[model samples]
Target chain A: MADITKSRTDTPTLWVERVHPAVWALGLVMLFMPAFANGFWLFQVFGWTFILGMIALSLMFLAGYGGMVSLIQMTVAALGGYGVAILGPSGVAQISLGLPWWLYVPLAIAIAALFATLVGALAVRTEGIYTIMITLAMASAFFYFTRQNYGIFNGYSGFNLVVPPQLFGVDWRQPVPFYYLTLGCAALAYAAVVYVARSPFGLALQGTRDNPRRMAALGFNVTAHRIAAYTFAGAIAAVGGILLVWQNAQIAPGTAGLPAVFDILVIAVVGGLRRPSGAFVGAFIYVLLRTFSPDVLTAFGLSNERFKMLIGFGFLAMVVFSPDGVLGLWDRWRARAGRRDPLTGKERG
Target chain B: MDGTNAMTSRLGAVSTGSALELRGVTKMFGALAAISDVTLTVRPGERRAVLGSNGAGKTTLFNCVTGDFLPTSGTIRLFGEDVTTFPAHERIRRGLRRTYQISLLFTGLSVADNVYLACRGVSRGRFSLLRPRRGDPLLTRSAELVEAVRLTAARDRLVSELSYGQQRQLEIALALAGAPRFILFDEPAAGLSPTERAELVAILTGLPSHIGFIIIEHDMDVALRVAESVTMMHNGRVFKEGTPAEIETDPEVQELYLGGGHG
Candidate 1:
């Protein structure tokens, strides 16, 4: 006999759904920021935040939804930055290939994504710490390789003059256009992550994350799903990396080193590893501290470099007080307000 | 290796039914033979149970058949196709699905989602993007599985919140979701209250005969009652195979397995 029993779907609270008030509020602030903020603030603060946020969000997609922690995300982004610089005009002499932007941008993204798939193929077989270590090793190796090679990488000086091209009657390198460019890419990355999570493939990846053995038994290819997730994350980071080069007008081995790689991890963890929006929140906090902490320290007669200490303290405080980051704290507040029957807290989207 | 195998499978006198045959199946972890040169066959639409005590290699045999572990040396034919080296997922895609002894599930997900994934397991659009998981086209089919397992009331509840009995029921729903012709259930009635055990036995025996099953249960009373035929294993080998009435009265079966401890 067919199902005579009552059937139902668990509807997540409607307020938290798409077109959320919080998203609207954020969008409104971002839209007005270019008009309100000076050029220094626009390019250094907000544009940088959007770029780093996109890169961090790429890591979040893998770490949060797929249960994988990759330390190679920043390094992967640098690969895109290097591609953009090498394929176009740069401070380095002949290393810049002088190719058209169209020829190089997609090629850069494809290379990063392919590399991510290869890394995922090898790493997905191992769990937790092993995955992290492998990614770290690969990232470290790439950093060293770029530093020593010098021919393409231009040694410690790296590449400079990696400017944004003026296209469609607008100078994109200008503060307003650059801010819009970064904001648009970040929004696309954010929306893509949200949509993919609800897709069947994303669902299957989560299932694999929850229980690999069971997912495999259920006719899902666990390894393939993980690699696919990595590839998608790679594309996202590549976009962010290209944006970073345009914003800085430079790319270097330092951009792909241990410090940069760890910074992205800290950002993703402090925002909320479970939510796509958390990446932006974490990046905003990070960029604000890096930009303003020096002035705050100098006012207290401490050397501005002590700002690193403040950042470290901020990271510790976040980890200890809110293990899942700022978004997690927000989720708890919402749970209490919602008064759901079981307050196990935030089955986040 | 490609077309010939496909053509032979398509045109050959192969039985498209819940049938399985194991020839000299053996599984060794280093030197220990978990399942030692055991051979058995189940006819289509027959009710069967594997009876063995703790450490008797019953689970190992189940693992080998389900492709969780490759047999040391043997041939496994499911529905008349040789699949000795096939992986667990491949075996499942071929209509032989199974449930674990420990009741493995995506505990973080809701009960409805667990059933929904099972529906997707056998579907062609399992990897499709740009489609939401909530309105999965096969939602109607998933609902039926939830209802069949009598989990519709608690469908929206998180799986971690369910009682042990309910988790076992969800396990059955997962196995059934694939629309598998043959299902292997490992220790299905192991951890349940007496009433729950009775209800499970009733559910197991009540399932349609078209879907055959091999249940590995240690409870002799429950296993014998629900199964039409029985295979008793001792020290990793089949000691006896017979009808329930015949096994319940055999002297050797009693001395070796049923009588000595639970026989």
Candidate 2:
């Protein structure tokens, strides 16, 4: 960038812009979360929410920042899950390479990122529904490829009991420890999304989203930015995938199924399509239904599978009421609040 | 492909080496010939206006030069480099920029961000995934450009919220961000009031003499005032080329272009 000078009053002089004091406070709170969450709720509920939310964050980043609605995020995550499965210790005979988790995790992320780049190069030219359809087609092909090719993906029954190894004298799979691990990673991914949103690359990407012709005319490579955004989104999804495998202790073809792919879309949209933090909020709501819906279904003399139906109803309501998701609702409500008094029904502004 | 052709015959203001030279550039859409065997040259830091009616291939010429559309058969040289095959972004990186006849902007972002992205587009720092968009040195350049375009008050506002005149000013500011060796403006005064057009003209005139420009405008008076030389185009060919004064007085040019310039 050119080294021109604007007003000193307008420009923020802070060099370390990513780490605000509040972020440190959030990190500190997250660091000590294990003290509050019991083992069952910690690993089975919140931990899974964080893991899925991280993956949804990748979609939110692409959809919100790049104006790209990719339906292949779960496919990318499944690729990462398979990476950990094939490359690490699992009960899949003749499949697991028994590599170190560190080695396998990075390898998984690389595979996912590579897949995303290829998909992006092929799909970036098409916009809106076409992009969604193309990515969906690719995702279906991948699912079939994994299912049919048992030599690597292990057919219908995927590698199971694939656990995280003890590192730094802590059993990583322990409920509290795993929850903390998931929280720490989730926080990092969240911070990264926020950071990237404020970065030069992110701004240029948003500019490309708004108007590619203008961005290209201004010397920014619009296609390159779009491709790079997908690659970045893939890496973030890969992280969620690794954590997901670590949490579930397995990997399978259904991981990247059509329903799973759209599940992420719902999670992202329900939270907010325009903000990163929305992913987490949406994931929490979705996971709550997953956790408690079985009991509710039983109380109503319905099958456990009906939980998804109930969730779908809620999802429909969310889409209809707040299409931009919760953040947009908040924005609308704030605007309304600014015009009317909060306690009394009188015009304020 | 020779630079010694009649394209550069008129020595305009700021005569450094040729900034852009097009030879035998032709573009066709099916049976329609948008540009046909047209050649032109632009010197560094010179203001040259393109005067033509609606179907005179003005936009097509600018598109081929800026790489928005590749010419079917041609050689476009930018700063002595053969750039006919270059992409739009690559051409921009090579110090060539242009504006759309209709304003195209990053409507989702602030005016400051729009200009800042333009400044940051060329530099290596645009890829940083963690840096702050605020406090960017490019933002300082953006601020300067905002002031130059008389958009300081609208700097923090969204592009969608700005009036049409403000949007046009922002369009010019975005082009200026790259500090291009050559800029091609397609109808800078297309949708502005008389007062706004005067302001737009003033902004273009206030630019440093070292900045080269190729402006295409139907407003002959404003185009002639900003430009040192004029290239009158007709049906995908250069009808005439001369200094603004010479073209204004030429009876042939009056019959072909200036007589119906308003519509």
Candidate 3:
């Protein structure tokens, strides 16, 4: 299992020994989760976690690898959801084009990716805080346009009953089936990001991030690489968006509002932007907190509306204490434990 | 096999014209003229050196030629094609390569990764999502480049872990990537030990005959040893152009530049 993380210089090993044991264990647990957990846990908790994690993972791809902290990922996801709603059959008979599931799915992802690429074309020209401002501005524009325009977007009412197609003779909206669906998509998206991180495109994107001038001198179109990164990330976010709309069977302008956009950024940051897995970890933590915090707040004689305050404080604490988030804290603990003598309980060095 | 042939064909096709030609190139920084009316030309396979003291606009001249800064006035051509308005990467894709004076490198990446990126930059599939397999030509080329720069032992090490001289060697390896017809080396031997300086000179002089280059150096020993011709600059102007022997023996050059006891 450890061979999977081996450096590129290492000799090739057997494929069976490549993956880590922990990964196999996690896979088994996720696969069998429906057997033990109830519908609420599968549908409301894990389903939402996987969906939000996928969106946050897109932002992580852009921010971590490309050094562009874009806040438009949520909006891109919303647009994807809207694409499915408007292009395929939905409750909104006025707009639904009644396209087949296969057709609408790809079209939705493509539209979202194209939107991201266009936004990236505009955003990559600027540096640092300006990128955040530009992406946020675009996200705001998309939200308002969706809210006001009644034609293509269906206006503020958005769309409802936008369910996933019935494939394999199973109702995909069922909690168990939906869990597997979201889990499969999230795993694939995670693997794709991890695999692409080492590809030529990914390496060059990181190169541009570290030193754009040097990359340009080396004959790389830094701007093109960045724009392409946004497109890739957008596709991932769009997939998540489609799942989200199906999970709730609805979507609105509020789906991609400013707060939601910022939420994805917060999720990625709180998970640790250094690694792809961090987004999922952050999303899981956020889902748990958002689900259980209201109960805890009410138990403590505080209004459930103050759940936001608790989340804000938790985020602040994470940033102030461990800027890299939960992963950094885990890493520090592991490093400390590694340095201690096992039997003597003393420092090794 | 096919990649090598394509490179050869590209090289053969562009073999006719001058490697680099700049006419009346001038660059200004608001109220200051960094380089003014600097006209220079290097023929195919020519080895030339630009010698000047600090503030002589030598770096600025390299910047203009590399498209790091667009000249306020003048026309630049590479392989007989006008490229005065081309971006840095566009010029680079046209076979113009450059090494920085300040050691610009991807410190977090491995040495091989850095060279691999340089090779991948000019090649097709710059946006490939597929990782290179074991027998990938770019990987082979990158490994060969690392070996050429004598850093194969540190190939897997992070660039930040390399010694200063090793970093400079890596810089040269990057510029040598792809089918470069012309290279602008900005002080390739700067701050090197005598042994490293010898290595730098060997690398510069051992390049193929079809590849021309302009070297900017404060080390006269290095500059004169590798370069056949010399262009001296003073106060943003061309002071003299001659062979290394002529520049070494010219009375005015001795009085103005070498008299300062530069080696």
Candidate 4:
């Protein structure tokens, strides 16, 4: 009966099977990572990668599934970071006078969400190149506003925030705690995105992307759906920001600047925009390269600064050869390889 | 096909409660009136064909009904509810669904996903965020409709990759996915081959009685095969209304549309 059920579901359909073996194997690698990796390396590189991956993953949900390419994800993250920093118990003199972390956290998330809503509303009014320009303009405006505002943002210096509240007497700044916290957030964010993508609203959002006119004819307000998608995307991105403040113990205008904004786009595009998992994969690769490239280049008898050139060339090559990004290419290769699972003895990814 | 499905040629289906009504509808693009003072009634289970030539107001009439453009003068009611002031999406929610002359589909998504999306639009409200799409009963219904349209073979293919005919089939599949009481087909057979066209005809003719449709077509034979009543539009107004045989034999229709002499 089980076999019959498996074949019945599998035959003549591309319904995504449960987590691929490759993903499972990767998860197992993560479980065993502490055995060999040093705390410092893991804390700085892997931790940052996962957080950035979460943010990029959120953007991927909007772009791939919702057919909206937003350039303001970094700005949203900055808002979240700023939210926590300014609202938490101790902030750089200008931002947070004194607010408990618990009260500050929710307030910051809400503010970030509201900020995202405004951006989504304005940006969604246009399509294609116009949308890109609008979002870019919004991001640029946010960057400048943060850079120049001394009263609320403390000018270019920004703010040094309190450590996130220690829960159950466990300090989150320690490497293991931070790593676990980041992993937990990433996992939750990933599951949420997948759940939403597979949800009725997600389907409708995609439908709006596919044919706004048809969706409208079917009683869907296309603009409203797009805005709602943006708001959802904002909430996810904002969570990453809260974590960002937790990690850096600070917030600055540079965090929301064009470079950071562009980096988020790079992470999402390089990760493979089609699936949520692509963001993590892309982030892992990006963080590894960005963190270690200087040392790796020096070891190879090159100037450390040359690493940026290499990264640029790599991005160019990836875009030219694989527009769908690495995960998409990997999926294509897997399909071509004709591999079958041992457990099921049927076609599976 | 049955007593319930039998054709009722009443001039106005409003007495039984119209699914849609367009009265004294007039539309102008700048100085040009694409349509003028037109009235149309789409009844429950009514299969209507709006027939016209290249410059005739066929698309214009459609635009007005779907709220793509508000008529200069007219009232559109759905199921006895006044809906002239409603926007396109509100009209859809009110049980009026439609397709386009061009197959407008989410080209990046799987065919199953496209239909599933449409079905969700019909079976649920637009704001349902908590309910997941996979394994949902209504989504299953969408998959069933995909099979009904004979698109099961290409269900997983991205809509962009499908052949033109398959895209049209998918388009109709999307329209039917919502299980709407009323559907508008704008030139459904525009680019289909003979076999595909016949298949479309069969699909349209075989739709369940609870559903209603208004079709716009240039192919007179296909229209004659499916539509219970024909509405001929020329110079914006509905020039004539009758069965297929009556329009084909009308001297005015023959002179203006079928050429100067009888075939």
- Candidate closest to the true structure, highest TM-score: 3
Please give the lDDT score for candidate 2. 0.85
How do all the candidates rank in terms of lDDT, highest first?
3, 2, 1, 4
- Model 3 lDDT tens row, B163-260: 99999999999999987889999999999999999999999989999899999999989999999999999999999999999999999999998885
How many clashing residue pairs appear in each of the predictions shown?
Answer: 2, 0, 1, 5
Task: Single out the weakest 10-residue window by summed lDDT for candidate 3 chain A.
Answer: A1-10
Which TM-score value belongs to model 1?
A: 0.91
Candidate 3 regions with alpha-carbon error over 4 angstroms: A1-9, B1-16, B260-263
lDDT of model 1 at residue A347? 50
TM-score of chain B of 1: 0.90
Model 1, position A117: C-alpha lDDT score: 86
Tens-place lDDT digits, model 4, residues A83-103: 877767555755575677678
The global Cα lDDT (0 to 1) of model 3 is 0.91
lDDT of 4 by residue, B62-180 (tens): 88888998888878777777778789977776567788898888886778777767766655455676754345576567668889999888877778899999999988887876546
lDDT of 2 by residue, A84-186 (tens): 8898889885989999978988898999899999999988999999999999999999989988998889888888978887788898899998898888889
TM-score of chain A of each: 0.91, 0.91, 0.97, 0.90
Candidate 1, number of clashes? 2
Alpha carbon lDDT at A207, candidate 1: 84
Candidate 1 at residue A257, lDDT? Answer: 90
**Residue A47 local lDDT, model 4:** 81
Model 2 lDDT tens row, B80-196: 778889888888876677888999998888887788788888666668876644455666677888899999988777889999989999999888875566789999999899999
